[model samples]
Target: MASPTQDGVLEALRPIVDPDFGKSIVDLGFVKNLEIDGGRVRFDIELTTPACPVKEEFQRAARDRVSALPGVDEVQVTMTAQTRGRETPQGGEDLLPGVRNVIAVASGKGGVGKSTVAVNLALALRGTGATVGLMDADVYGPSLPLLTGVSGRPETRDKRILPHEGLGLKLMSMGFFLTDDSPVIWRGPMVHGLVRQFMSDVDWGELDYLIVDLPPGTGDAALTLTQQAPLSGAVIVTTANDLSLIDARKGLAMFEKVSVPVLGIVENMSYFVPPDLPDRKYYIFGQGGGARVAAEIGVDFLGEIPIDPRVVEGGDRGRPITLHAPDSPPAAALREIAGAVARKLVVLAERTPAIADANISWVTN
Candidate 1:
């Protein structure tokens, strides 16, 4: 009996079509690292986005197809996802070299837990086996160093800033450069320059997703990022309350004015669930305000994150709940929101024509 080969395996998988793009995984360049050891076979399927709805379906089909190949005794299939835009890069030293998708997590006002959402969301995406980076663009209030549980200034290597790594993520933040109590009071131009440097100077090699934590409000940071980064889309973070909702609308409008697609809205601190009463629910922030705002704005309502004390404790203690207490309510909620965000990326990538046109300006620079 003859053993199976890589070519034969590729041929078998060439027929598996991605539901979002209606193209075979092989033809779409999703298959990676095909290996054959006697009767055993293993390979990875890199989806266009981590939130692809047909992820499980694609995995099942690939395994079944490869297992049916000649002399195949065992088959293992791994799924990986990356965000892609329509614009193709020109040959040269690439800008943001190795970064596939950039997502800005923004808000219209402060104290809405935007940093917390950004940190947990990045961890959630990393859980899906895609390389992820969390860039803290909130110069005045960089919290990733504390949230990711890592503290120290980034190292310089060959003139490129090396991001601090911890909690299964690569992180860059102004927090790392300052003491916990120090303040960053810079002019508008300085702030813009720093944001630009973060994008062009950091050595984020080959990340599947770079989740940017933008400062609260539709101010200089948000405007600078919208005009500069090759963003796949923006995820607006809002709380369940009238004031927060009103500000969130401004954030949404800012993205719209800049032609940045609003992927969805995440309702952080949506409600409060007392630890003592597991079954009881409390309408602390006023119910359904986030969802209502999302509907009113005509963007996808990613999901709601109930207010939990652990979430606050985790952030203060430099331990994100998504990693420390994966089973907790807020942690689980973050994962769900992450999944929804991922799925929304797929929709944006497939359905939006602007992403393609926008890519041309950044990818070729």
Candidate 2:
């Protein structure tokens, strides 16, 4: 029989819905087991994806929602991810084993500074004492070579591709294979295979974060990476420009189909202030576009980075802004955002208390 508080706990959660699935977790039978004593509540929750970020969120929400119950004291939610995947037609998660965390930086449209955001953010994460890797998934326009300043062909040993070191990062890109001035073209499946090979054949080593700078707009590369990598989360990069917002929406939807949690949204090139006039602000791409999209998607708006010319110079010279001018505005913003993102990833690995079931007691007095 259910106590008043136990029933009240369930009653409070009757309206919570999964952000991606749009179904109530309780109705989905994700609330596996429940027990109540005195005022504490303990339960096991299951998810359609073992690594779904919402697994923790649901628990936290449950805890908060149930704490309002008449006699509740504590809430314990043990979440387990179960593979309930239906075959995703194109961009569903087909994670390569052993990949720690893959974070893709994407944009809704070109010229919105998505690539710049990716490079700087990757550098910022490195600053936080984590081993990081950058995959130039934008094969046709591999900017990492230009940004990282590694031009020679990547050497191969043991038949596995060795990533080039740039701005203190391990890198793999098509630009390494092409001359600095060469133009290249690729077919669909061929390009897809290349993305796959980069992941399977490279020696990524023990990386804490793998920042993948995806091509502008949702396309083959975006879909391919989603299917090939065990991505922990993604960051949608966009400007405050209307066109960019449209593109950002497409990218967000692409990741959604594959069950990828959008860690947050990043507004890049958010503001441009002239050198002479520090106080005057220029809304070059319009204001609040990125924040608006973030709200619309129900994701955390990590932060906005001002357009810094130093960033372009750094990328052009094979030095990322975070490395060249760690004190610069954009670099500082990236560092903060990077650290926050890393913390968000770890939050998914919530620790379960090891208390023996028989050793617990509830006080009703």
Positional deviation of 217 in candidate 2, in angstroms?
A: 1.1
TM-score of each model, paired residue for residue: 0.81, 0.68
Model 2 misplacement above 4 A = 1-98, 243-245, 274-282, 351-365
Encode model 1's per-residue lDDT on 1-365: one tens digit a residue.
68999889999999998765678889888999888899999889987776576789989999999889889999999988656653434542345767767889998777788899999999998987778999999887888877877888789999999988888899999888886595768788888788878878999887878899998888776787776777778999887774355676787888886677888888888777788887776878777777788888788888888888888888888888887788888898898888777766775776775565655554344
User: What is candidate 2's lDDT per residue for 1-365, written digit by digit as tens?
Assistant: 33445556667776778665567777777776788887778887776544354556788888788877777777888877543211212332233334456788877676777778788777776765556788888876788877887878999999988999877889888888886476777777887778778877888876667888877677776676665555667888776654345566677788787666788898887887777887666878788777777888688888888888898888889888888888777787887777667655654432211111111211000
Q: Number of clashes in model 2?
A: 3
lDDT of each: 0.81, 0.71
Residue 152 lDDT, candidate 2, scale 0-100: 86
Q: List clash counts for every candidate, in order.
A: 0, 3
Question: For model 1, where is the 10-residue window of minimal lDDT?
Answer: 86-95
**Candidate achieving the largest lDDT:** 1
